[model samples]
Target: MNDYENMSDEQLVQLSLEDQDCFYYLMKRYDIKILRYIKRLTTISQEEAEDIIQEVFIKVYRNLNGFNRKLKFSSWIYRIAHNEIINQYRKTKLRLAMIPSNIEDQANLIDSINDTIEINGAYENLEKDERVRKALAELPDKYREILVLRYLEDKSYDEISDILRKPPGTVATQINRAKTSFKKIAGRHQLNTGIVK
Candidate 1:
């Protein structure tokens, strides 16, 4: 068994500085995560997502020394990924798709407006998943990004703050506002908001 497998990110980073091979461990650790993140944030196919992941890791490698130890390594990596995604968007004007895209079982979206939008069986028959996807697609980039980070990626407020470079308070505010906007969109779709009577 290789002790490298158990080494912390910081440890791997230090070792990587001494031995280029150690950097591969860091890339292995985050390859899938970065790929999924890119896929979620862009409508690009898996092939394109893979290419983006390569670019993200390359940037990570080049800027490895610039990494801020004060932040969670994962957060810093994600910030890099986020910036790369934005750059691609600027060039192509692409947008993110819903992640963990189980419309049928989307707990976060459902739970957000579950109070006001009761999902009765009759309403549930109205293709709620498609409706939710549409509503999410309609959301502005900032709102969607927060929801994805908090819900899909399952990141903590502090982690989100680190990645977005926003205060936790601001992240919370954005989430609340995103939920409110989502509720309005869901209502418009008539996904059985119970108020459609």
Candidate 2:
């Protein structure tokens, strides 16, 4: 049994190219994260989302040699998933679903955003915060996606930049803008949330 868990993504990529069995480990590493990301972006049934995931994996396998070693493998994979979602929306006219599915993910996202925006006790009563949820779903795709990448996914600025194919400066600016937009929306919705600056 190979210590696939101990191997770096780059190492796994190389091994996967030579032995297709190694690719299974790579897919296992990313399946759930990518699925959640897809769900975050669109309101699709589980079967539909699984189909999209299969397509992403197939594309990743085909483009394995094109992977840029300079980028973290996770970032590269996410970029692929992002493009695939956009393509699916274009092809099928799927409605983008910015609201997270479950309360746990919603609370986690709120907690993470609080790390930057200083929301007071938002996570504690997240289940009751329909206004906050509405505010999030109302955000433009660019802002919502940026927030999901930065807060929910816990991606660093550089990682987000690579994943979104944007410059690092732009990534930082967008995150700031997203926080501001969320604050404004929260205010308009009369959310019982407290934001410190």
Candidate 3:
């Protein structure tokens, strides 16, 4: 409904706190995006991902009154979701990013990774780019997260810092380190994947 859609996320937050029904609009706008982010960040199955998303939205609603006006709503919600993901990982040692978000350019980069794979033999299936998946999976958690936020979400350094609750300078350092680590992993595997830089 235009009435709901026309309102900014901050305005809707105020409305939702007063009337729970108003929250659905907020859910509708972010559910899928956050869902995809969940999957990309974790190896959770579709069902589990949905459960996490439900938890995320519930947290958002419960914390509605605490939402900060100085920050973007999207950033705030993402920070909550990221914390949830970290908590899930801590509790269950759940999976982290293994697949890129299916960006054509990223897919191309994944394919290039195949050439760099020092594995004994080529993966029979590249459809899911399993080799590429493994490479991403091998990355340290901090590195994997930075790459996903930067590339898949197309987020800026400040945005990523906000989501990760780190200083902007730290985020920048991690991103650089992530790229270097990614390259090192490729080197260890003897894959000649082109420069990720």
TM-scores, all candidates, are: 0.85, 0.90, 0.81
Which candidate comes out best when scored by TM-score? Answer: 2
Tens digits of lDDT, candidate 2, 28-68 = 99999999999877889999999999999999999999999
lDDT of 1: 0.77
Candidate 1 C-alpha lDDT tens digits along 9-128: 998888888888889999999998888777666778888788789999999988889989998899999999999998888887765665334443255544544543455445453377
Provide the clashing-pair count of each candidate structure: 0, 0, 2
Error of 3 at 107 (Å): 1.9
Q: Is candidate 2 or candidate 3 better by lDDT?
A: 2
- lDDT, candidate 2, residue 121? 45
Q: Residue 16's C-alpha lDDT in candidate 3? A: 90
Sort order, TM-score high to low: 2, 1, 3
Best by lDDT: 2
State the C-alpha lDDT per candidate.
Answer: 0.77, 0.85, 0.77
